[model samples]
Target: MVHVNPVQVIVDPITVLWLNAFACNLTKSLSTAGSAPAPYIDLRLEAIMPRLVLETTHDYPLQRDRPSTLQLQTTRLLVCNYRSPDPTAPGSLAGLTKCLERLQAGEMAFGSDFPARDGDLQMVPDRLVQHTLGKDHVQPAPADVVASVPDFRRDLPGRLLWEEPRDVVFIHMDPFWGDFFGTSAVRHRPVPFIDAIPVSMWVYQNRNKVASVSDGRVSDLTMVLHVPSLISLQLNHFQYLFLLRQLERLSEMSALLTLDAERLLGAAGAGSQCVSAALPQLDISLLMPCLLSSKDSSGGDLSVFPDSSSVTSFQEAGLLPTRVDSLSEPLAELGAGLSQVKRGLNSFLSSLDSALKSPDDQSDTMSVMSDMSSDSDSYVLLNLELDKSESVDPLFVVEGALKRVPSVEIASEVTEDTHSEVSLSSAMRKRDVISALTLRLGRVELVHQGAGLSSSLKLNMRHFAAEQCAAIGWDEFQAKFQLRTKGWQGLDVSSPPCSVRLRMDSTFVPVANQRQHRINIREQVSSELEVRASELELALLMSTVTNLTDFIEDEILPVPLPMELYLEHIKLRLTEDRPPNNITSPGVVPLDLRLPAVHVTRDGAGVFTVQQPTPGGAGAGTGPSGSRSLVDVASSFNNPASGSEGELGRLRRRCQLLEDQLEQRRGSEQRLSQLTALEARCREAEDEVLGLREEKEVLMKTLSYLKQEFLRLDTAHSRRTDAK
Candidate 1:
């Protein structure tokens, strides 16, 4: 008998909920009004400082207000370089020279913010802050720690020291590096570009000081890229076009990161003795913005209003300047823009597909090396997840990237080994750079502004060499992928909750040049998929259903038509490892099979009829009614009438049965409708919250303006008093 795990049933939902809540909390306004409320910056500093002074200081743009900020903690090697306005200055190249010297000497301290800096230069925070800001977006405050004393605790006179530690390093370079930014990869700029893009590196260092040359340990390095501007772009006209544009920039950024990491690591003996740093594990998250300001929605100037409730609330609160009655022009433009975006996407995909299918020897390995490593015996893994409140769709950027597999082979110094069976081509084919992949997507709606999507994903890969191969062994793996879509539209089709699961044990063998090689033929894999009926329906199905049948049904029946496909075991292998030359029979064994069972629920009371399959490939035959179904056993709902039904009289029994049936029907019908309404209400509430948040941010920014106004009023009042 197989025991079921209850944790598997609830883990995904719980994970999604927890992650969504965590992200929400992370993106909230940092400037809240309360004693010991949260870590915040002093606005009074800004109230006194001049704009030019603030601009000249370190952390210029991101000095004060940043709401869309997230923090991470991990040990990473920091490599940084900067440019000076006066190239002829005495210490113009001093910082960069010092950093290079320290790296070569292995005297680089991890705690140091800028090892390159001298005592003369101002000290900045030792963290990287990446922003995908629109024109109206505020720069985030640098992750800085300062001493504070609460008014209530002033009598005790104790200092509250807040420590904010970030492991990543930001290297600000010259804006006009042009082709001199290390790699040949070029950034395509349709829109105006930011002055300079800061490059961040998450470095992994071998900790053992006394380790042998071949005894260095390699752990999977994960990179988390958070871009909150994607959500805002989806509401605008050129959503897809902008994404395609940003994807190119992202590729360029990744390439620069790889080159910088290699430079730093190579200096520290990471790439010495034939052991090289592998590509990092990429965990990319596209977070939705907390506030959808006018610039975020309209792309540039004109603002297309969101929902009615939000508009009404904003107008009532005296936030809106003017109300535009007609949406036809903007809506038409949006439609036209969507079509253009679709065409552009199709063209790009086609070109990308052709590029992958054809071989181009002229393509340099250095360019791709940014996103992927070409080091000997290295592995790479990528995980891209986009989360919103209303929709969760598959990211096409990942799909496009996956289609063109990067070559992970690096030519090493060849040693004469004539007897060895491993050739260069065979080794390359056997190497699994991307060991495992998982994609979870929901419906992506471009036109709907009120809808939101939330998603979470992780990727991991391992590289094995002769020294570490013994430690790598086969282990049992169990994973479940789930997809949930609401208001899913298609050609006369309906969508229900779908889940796919796999259980297997996999292993790898170290082949030529001590590279990790995947063994695919011997591994036995088990797979399962389940689909259930739900209230969600497609609009296109209504007319088609009416045309197909005489009965013009207004609603679909929430039938107990739960379908499941289960494959017990699958494996591929030869009959013998070694065969005779005159072997007449190519020995192959027939697969052993077991009869599958079928179970279905009859009504909403969790009652099921378990049936055995009939001969001649017929459907499941009826079984005894009393056989308890799997649904009943796994149901989370508490049934008060169950186990005590016999105690009731005939009249009570009849009433109870009717009541239960009515309740179930009502619930099934109202659940989807109620969810839709609740989601709309949630969006409205979020909009109000965001409006208030933006208002607070504005006040903080205009603190200096308020001070100037106060001084002018005081001067006028003093003159009037003197005249009197």
Candidate 2:
């Protein structure tokens, strides 16, 4: 098997000529079939291949045709630099275009000589080619060449020199550096020179300088192709705004421009001229005012709008007022009043400061102290009067006045010891009074501490007493006092009354009565259990009877035995004289009588024997008396109305027979329908045959008359020939 391998070759200036010659010779030798024998060239050694590099000149080896079987495949096409004598001429691209047209086999790419001999051309290393072709294979530049070449200085289009028609035109501009297009020369002017090409899409990079064309100038300039294809001009943020401004200036010329704006800004900055041009187009007379308000409200940068020129332009257009109106004299008076108030406040503050620093401050302090001393004396006097009022009890005062009466006079005959004793008793009574007062005052507080009352409730109660005591009537107060002192004597506040009653009842019930009640309940329960036991026994007996009946009807009656045997078994059980449980007392009784012994096989055959019992009274007979097959019994059982057992079998067979007859009848009906259709078709065919026969007869008659006419014409022609 021959192997085909893809190989890429890089051809530089040094190897271009020699590699081209070698490719040409190899093509020639491979094309001449059978000129070189296979034995002369070792197949294995010939398989070891080398890269096939071709030059970019007119004499490249791909121009020649080679045999299809040749294993060589061109993987990469590297075109070297080709320079024309005149750099400015368009025809200089012809050679490179021709070279590209010849390299149609593989990935064809173009590269220029870096560090051009002319200083105007900048060296931009083709990073894509260098990574693909390996760094060592791509020729390196000399040390004298400048490494830092500005993007704008690079003559990208001039170096490649291919001015052939392009589907897309990419015009990249560097913002920091100026290019040959001279975009940076006139900063405010639109770059109108770039629209010469009629490409489908015009791509501008970095800055959208071309979109600043004035409306009148844009109408005069012919930029777009008039084909049916969609022509788009891409612009950046600033260019988009400029296009809108231009559209505003020349609304009639809108159909001529196709602008595609990417990365549009929410707001744009424009010059005074641009804003003025766009005002009418946007149909917003207050556009500048709205923008200013939005800027002020948002506190955004003023740079979002155009420079100071826009404001001046707005003034010039008479959209803004040039001067402000003055206020009236009354408003001016208000301002003067406010100034006077401010001065008055300052004067008052200065006077206060001076007063604070005066030496007469000591006299003022002495007067303030004397006034405070007099106020304290009055406060003490008020306190003394309140104490006198609180200390004077009404009952004591009334009793003292009564004692001062003449009838209440007391004798002055008391001894010294009696006086001492009376004084001690009086002192003890005072102590007791003080203690009782304290206890009464602290009663609610003590109750709150012991009753777990919340602080909020205690405070509310205290506040309620202090604020609402006068609102209470005398009767209500007496009632509350009586309840607190005497009503609680019989009340059980520790537990609920119902629970207490229940507890008392539990303790007071007689134990003997409870025992007797439990005994009576036990007796009643025992009687109910005995009744349930009897009912259960009756149910069990009924279930047993039901099960036995089902077993006899389903299993015993269905056995393939004569009905006489079943009747005999029933009779034997019924004729027993003893109780049913004692029927097995007389066991194994034998008699000299004959009984039919039956046996059945899986094939539905029954064997029967009539056994004659021997004189010794055994269950089996000594000799075979008679043997008979059950075929005769089965034949009798096969009768339709033989017995209840055979009735179901007969009905099933009858149903199957009726179904078979139904199927046959349906088949016959279908056949009759088919025969009817076939007969109708046959009659139609016969009628058609009859019609054809009549038509055939008519045609035969026409042919006979034509033959006769032909013979008559022949005779007339012969007679005419004789007359001539």
Candidate 3:
């Protein structure tokens, strides 16, 4: 019971064939059962079966006549692979249209093997039907059928006449299927589907001829324009313009327009103009290339076009807008000023080139002078008058005026050693005058203006030794003299002369070392005078001295002199008799005129004057005044106690000097100790050398004795050998 026999089943050829046919029939029945009638099933099955075989071989139908009544009742999906049999043959699409009519098909679709060669075959049936219907004088589609089609769908409704060729609603012309047939027969002609079909959408795979669509029927059609194919078509300017216009019309008709291109309808040659002009009317969202490539196309360079009027037209058409000029006023002014300066600099350079070529060319120089003169006038016009009540500084006003004046270059050929008398330019002379006045006035505001002048003067003075100028100092180039002789002669009256004098006390001349002592005394006096002068200037500004002349006479001038001079003058006055002019009246009794007399007076000419004691009356006053004028002078040449703060200050100074001398003496003692040590070491070395010389002499004597003994031995040995 458990043993199972292996069944041997064999299949016959006829049975296998029958099973295969039944399976195929069942599949066909399942696929077409919904739309097909039961009685016409066999005819529909036969029709569809032959199509599958014909597609692969691309063979024509054996029976070229109309279908039977049963086949007509069945729904048909006729796929025509429109490969033009003969391109030169007229009415080439007639056979395809007649075949669709014989089949009584409501819908037709086209496919291509080689899309580029076969071109757009979807429009072939439409164009053929239009030619037939025009001859037959047939009416177009009814309003009801046209209105039933949605505006967004790509397909339009078929025409009312049964004899008219049905619109080829769906197309797939992929080159992967088969080889190319040829260019589309209806490519250049108007699309006939727009007239025949009111609710039809046409698809193109290879090339697009959107411009070939009739302008009248453009509103009825929904075109899915393939932009890549459109570009490949290489349409001219007018074609692009026409296509854009048709798209605009379709949009107005509420018909759907889709662009299937990858990026944009790229412009070639004159097509760019059309693209630019048509961009505003397009649905920019669907046009990726237009969106990306020309996002700023509205602001593109209008100057690239030859005709300005065309650019204006484009602007008016809303394709482009005029760019607004938005420069700020201040920036514009700055730009203009920079441009003017550049022009002026260029002109000046050119003039310089010509002037350098010919030294005698004075034209450029004259023009420069004219420009400078004009600038000077402008500077004068721009001068701001100061308020008198503001109490402004005079020096500051003078500096501001100098700053406003135009600067000029000065040329000179002066050498260092050889005094080649080079003439100064007018500008240089003017600058020198200004510098001299500034120095004489001693104003800080004028320091910058005089910097160049001071540098040039110092450069000239450096060639000579200081000793050469000892007699005159730097007075040969006196600031006052230069100002007076130059253009600043009138300024001399306004500015007081800078006269500085150092007066030494007469009590301190040493006849033996008079020259050297005088030099030392003069230096000390000058230093003291400089310090006192600075103090006086600060005091004049800060102290309660109403009259500067009186202040100078009482404070500055008398403070620099030694206290001994004051005491000497007082003593002389006390010893001598009063002058008769000093007697006030008989009753007044000369009012003790012996008291320390200062005798300060303003002369009749308003010049300050101070009276000095008679030279004979004061013995110390009889000596030179250049050596003992100031407090330092008193310390150097007179008693150390004189003009010092007190005896304590003198004592402190003396102690400091004694300490310095003590240090120097200690250093000298250390040097002497070191020298004594070195002498002792040298004596030891000399003794050692003498002992070495005695030793050497003994060695020499011993060697001489050895040589004599050797000579005797040699004589004895020779005598022995002779005996042998």
Per-candidate Cα lDDT values, in order, are 0.27, 0.25, 0.26
Q: Rank the candidates by TM-score, best first.
A: 1, 3, 2
Model 1, which residues run further than 4 Å from truth? 1-189, 192-630, 633-638, 641-724
Query: Which pairs clash (backbone N, Cα, C closer than 3 Å) in model 2?
Result: none
TM-score of 1: 0.18
Judged by lDDT against the true structure, how good is candidate 3? 0.26
Model 1 residue 453 CA deviation (Å) reads 30
Best by lDDT: 1
**Candidate that beats the other on TM-score, 1 or 3, i.e. the better one:** 1
Listing every candidate in turn, what is its Cα RMSD in Å to the true structure after a full C-alpha superposition? 30.7, 57.4, 55.9
User: Candidate 2 — number of clashing residue pairs?
Assistant: 0
Q: Which stretches of candidate 3 lie over 4 Å from their true place?
A: 1-424, 427-660, 663-667, 670-674, 680-684, 687-691, 694-698, 701-705, 708-715, 718-724
- The weakest ten consecutive residues by lDDT in model 3 span 272-281
Q: In model 3, what lDDT does residue 391 have?
A: 45
Q: Deviation in angstroms for 3 in model 3?
A: 99
What is the C-alpha lDDT profile of model 3 across 305-358, one tens digit per residue? 111122111122121111111122233455556556654654565455544554
TM-score of 3: 0.15
